[model samples]
Target: MEFQATLGQIVTAVIGAGLQLRYLEEYPEPFWRPGDLSAAAWRGRLPNAFALVASRPG
Candidate 1:
């Protein structure tokens, strides 16, 4: 899938994550953020998996 978001969001998220982890952060927003992306900000940062299972309304 393609990646979305302007350069600002990318920069902000990266910097925030970096400061939070005290390292150079480099990871996409976890869980969900439009496009299907995989990122690793700080070391030991757990990433979600493929084929998400969601429940439907009755």
Candidate 2:
């Protein structure tokens, strides 16, 4: 598989597109536990995962 954009690049592109960044977080391994598959539980469990919340201006 080929690599694409990095997290920073993504954020930059989002902002450039006129979206407002509300929340941004990096989910490291320590933030999760085994057998945690729920949305709130699996956030930091997966590898190379991040939580980014953005929205367009009203």
Q: What CA root-mean-square deviation does each model show from the true structure?
A: 14.1, 7.1
* Residue 27 alpha-carbon offset, candidate 2, angstroms: 0.9
lDDT score for residue 34 of model 2: 65
TM values, all candidates: 0.26, 0.60
lDDT, residue 18, model 1? 48
C-alpha-based local distance difference test score of model 1: 0.42
